[model samples]
Target: MKVDRVLLIAGGRSGEHEVSLSSAAGVLEALPYDADVAVIAKDGSWLLGPDALDAIDAGEAASGGHPFPPPVAWGDYDVAFPLLHGRWGEDGTIQGFFEMLGLPYVGAGVTASAVCMDKDLSKRVLQQAGLPVVPWEVVRKGEPAFVGLEPPFFVKPANAGSSVGIARVERYAELQKALEEAFRYDEKVVVEQAVSEARELEVALLGNVRAEASVVGEIRYDAEFYDYETKYTAGAAELVIPAALDPGTQETVQEMAVRAYRLLGVRGMARVDFFMSGEGELYLNELNTIPGFTPFSMYPRLWQASGLTYPELLSRLVELALE
Candidate 1:
């Protein structure tokens, strides 16, 4: 299917609002078709076109500052390419809204988006499917903090991206503050044992029914880990495409990434991250259904290394949505 008018949705009511806008900017610059822009304000107002604020409100009357019905009509475009990240956008809300509108959009569906957004649920599902995941424990707010694992553990919100609410606690004394910080973003928190001397590897997957994994990529950072700052700040971290892994290990990582993508029923695209322990054990980390598309983002860079240009990637994603 040839795509003409593309709905480029971006900026949502989430901690990742700025990130979403940046990603959408990249998409807007590279998209090959005629694309319209929609900005979802932090207060949940759906503003269409460049004059978002002062422009005419096309959505249903704001009911308590929440736009129940989106202003975008199904006939306005052929497909939607949502660059909204984090809570209200990537966590299945917008996906469901598009479904109700009977509009095809890029990335995973409602169920996959919701499931992958929750760390605890995604880990459990991956574990049940005989996939290797880091050993971890879950805790809820107001519950007795259980440092069941070792002191070097990571505390993160159950449903968040871009490392918004993540803490690396190296000692038991730091557990309380870390958990409290994590609880700020979500009621449920996850505590996972930190993988020591592990190299972070990521694989990008694309497709609807049949997925294809890109060449493996490695993340090298000077920080304790790939936190939010290291991720967005240019030069803070280096992405080594076609990660220097042995042939066997490279194939293994790519295969596992595709398996996880299919297991989660991810359509369109996903960036599957993994931890390669010093001991050679591979631990499957969380999957980002709608990974960042910034110039420095790994998802598009990996594809670029694998022969897909930025514009080509954007066009391919829109095509996947149409399919």
Candidate 2:
């Protein structure tokens, strides 16, 4: 069956714009349609059709030399496959736009995106849901933030992703700098106790009600933490799929991953990250509503290794979104 419309929106004002574009590039190639890609540049611009990439390089929202295109009508496409990550795209802003336009875009809805984008709220919901999220405190703007929270905790923007403005403060002396950095991204900041000697594990959750968990994967970053550089730049870190763990522990991780997905009301797909301590205890990490889509990305790779081909995975997401 041919899909009438599938706009793969990528690039955004957020720090993860490049990652989003990389993801959109992959989705553009895999979508059923041969020529239906929309490049949403970082500067609040839109580039449609074949020359989207060139338009991106031209540093404008639209391709020059063409008449200004009016705002796209909602009915233009059956589905909008948004590849936007962080800031204006993922924080319910674009999702709200899609809702106003009566568009059925892929990924979590507005409420889910809003809650997930705000780390403090996400943790609170998880805590209320009887999930094991690290203890955290919210430091809103214009307040003394250095006090109250324990030292050696993670300082991150309240509503940011891709580890943007994230700081791993190992001491009291580092708390202020970390808070400043995190506050730069957003008015609010989240400070949580660092889980030392914990292994980073990630599980891909797919679907809505009948969510399925992919084989657990682990991230091994050589840096002090899995910051932005360690996530995108080559040689920054290594990813281990089907992370080696005892059968019982593996089942526990899988269960936690699914539970987190359900509690967040996440739909379509999410990458649930966890911090497995040296004693085998697992702590819930944040969820990625719009994860990377590169061919080598873990989201697709996890499914591929679990018997789902790349095209099949891509098709599954679109199908799930439409449903």
Candidate 3:
């Protein structure tokens, strides 16, 4: 497909709005084609052109543009690249909009995006597919936060990303507080058993039907866990590409990543995360459709270690969307 003008959409109604703008800024700097920028403000307003770009560059809230559908002509762009993260953006909302418009957009389609955005649902699907996933219990709104799992649980919003609205609880008394925090972001919550001293491994996948996995990457962090703050804060965590794993382990991680991607119907691009316990048990953590494209993000860096440059990675994603 011969790519030309692109519509890059960013920001969202989710807590990851700022992070999306940051990622969009990186994409704008490296995107190889003529791209129009659109910023969806926190209040759900759509800002286009210079106003959108300026807000993304300034890392502030956008002021102008209409709501829902932007005032711009969508036919001018060849493809849509949604850089928005979390709920309304990454959770298949915008993807469906693009689908209705008969436009090819980057990342997974509606069903895949919706399923993967819900951690509890995605884990259930993974478990049913015979994949190794950490034990978790789902608690819906107005329900008792009763989990059979032991203490030291990671309570999180089922539909949120970037570790937002997540709490690590060490005792039963703290479970309510964590549940409350998680419920603030989503109706459903997932209480997952925390893997002790686990090494965070991530694999980046690209393509549609026959997806490819990049070199495994490990996240080394000094924080209590890889939370939202640690993720966006510069120098808070180190992403070690070609993670220090044995050849067999690396191969296993890559294979599992691609398998999960295919099983979940993910296409274009995704970052499959895993947790390796101190006892060496591997667990599929979660998969991120439209993974972060920021300078510090692991998805791009993983592909870089696997011999794909950043600009090349972006171009390939657009190509995959058209394919």
Candidate 4:
């Protein structure tokens, strides 16, 4: 199947909008040399010509502030690849819209997107399904207190990504400030028990059934956590391809990644994140259904190390969607 036009949709109603733009640019660069690439910016506008930098500076999109333009017509393009992360973009919203528009897209469908977007919900589903997730509590707005979860915890928005509104608090006194910061991006905040000496590991799972897992990659954040800066800012962290792990542990992590993928009904591709404790326990962190497709992104990097190049990976994703 040959794709004529590839639409890389980015800049969404989320705090990770800037990162989304960066991801879109990477996708454009990875497009097949023969395919035509079109860039869509924030504010539901289009970007053309060679001035990518100038167009990005002209407009910005904020959550609940950027109104989507008229829905895209079916067959406007061969496939819609949304690199947007967080809230409106990663959740079922945009996926549902495209489905209604009858457009084929790269990545998970509506139900899977919605489940994976909600941290609390996704954890519940995974844990209930016999998967391992960290201890946490979901605090809805207006609650006088968040309890049953230990302090020195992480307070984050339930739906945002790239750790946009995540805060690490060590005491009860700091809970208020953390929740307030988290609420700025989302009304619901997740207070999770901190995992000390925890290793940040991620596995890129591609394909439908018989999905393959990229060699696990470990990320060392220069910052406290892998926040927006650590993820986007140059040299904010170190990426370890083929994370050092015993063969047994590696196999378990890969199996868990596939299990999580199917449990959530993920389709084309997903990056399953995990925390490798000192005891060698691979705990599920969260799954990124529409994980970044950038060249430097772990999703592609892991695959590259696993013998697939960026262009080949993009080609596979397009084929998976249109096949």
Candidate 4 residue lDDT tens string, 1-323: 66677666777657777777777777777788333333345444544434333434433433221234533344658888887788878898889978987888888899999999899999999999999999998888887764677777899999988988898888888999899899998788889888877999999999976688989989997677788778878888898999988888889999999999988899899999999877877689999988876699889999999999999999899888886
RMSD of each: 3.5, 2.5, 0.9, 2.8
What tens-digit string does per-residue lDDT give for candidate 1 at 1-323? 76779888777777887788788777777889998877777777776655442221332212123274665666878898888888888889989988978888999999999999999999999999999999999999988876689868899999899999899999899888898888888999999989989999999999998998899999999998889999888899999998999999999998888898889998999999999999999999999998998876999999999999999988888889988
* Ten contiguous residues minimizing lDDT sum, candidate 4: 58-67
**lDDT of candidates 1 onward, in order:** 0.86, 0.80, 0.91, 0.80
Q: Enumerate residue pairs that collide in model 4.
A: none
CA lDDT of 274 in candidate 4?
96
Predicted structure 2, TM vs. truth: 0.92
Model 1 pairs whose backbones collide: none
lDDT (Cα, tens digit) per residue for candidate 2, span 162-257: 899998887789887788888789999988888869899888889988799888888898798898888888877888888888888878988988
On TM-score, the leading prediction is 3
What are the runs in model 1 whose C-alpha is more than 4 Å off? 52-68
* lDDT (10s digit) by residue, model 3, range 1-323: 77779999988889998889999999989999989899988888988878898899888674556977778788888899999889998999999999999999999999999999999889999999999999999999997766899989899999999999999999999989899999999999999999998999999999999999999999999998999999888899998988999999999998999999999999999999999999989999999998999856899999888999999999999999889
What local lDDT score does residue 267 receive in model 3, on the 0 to 100 scale? 90
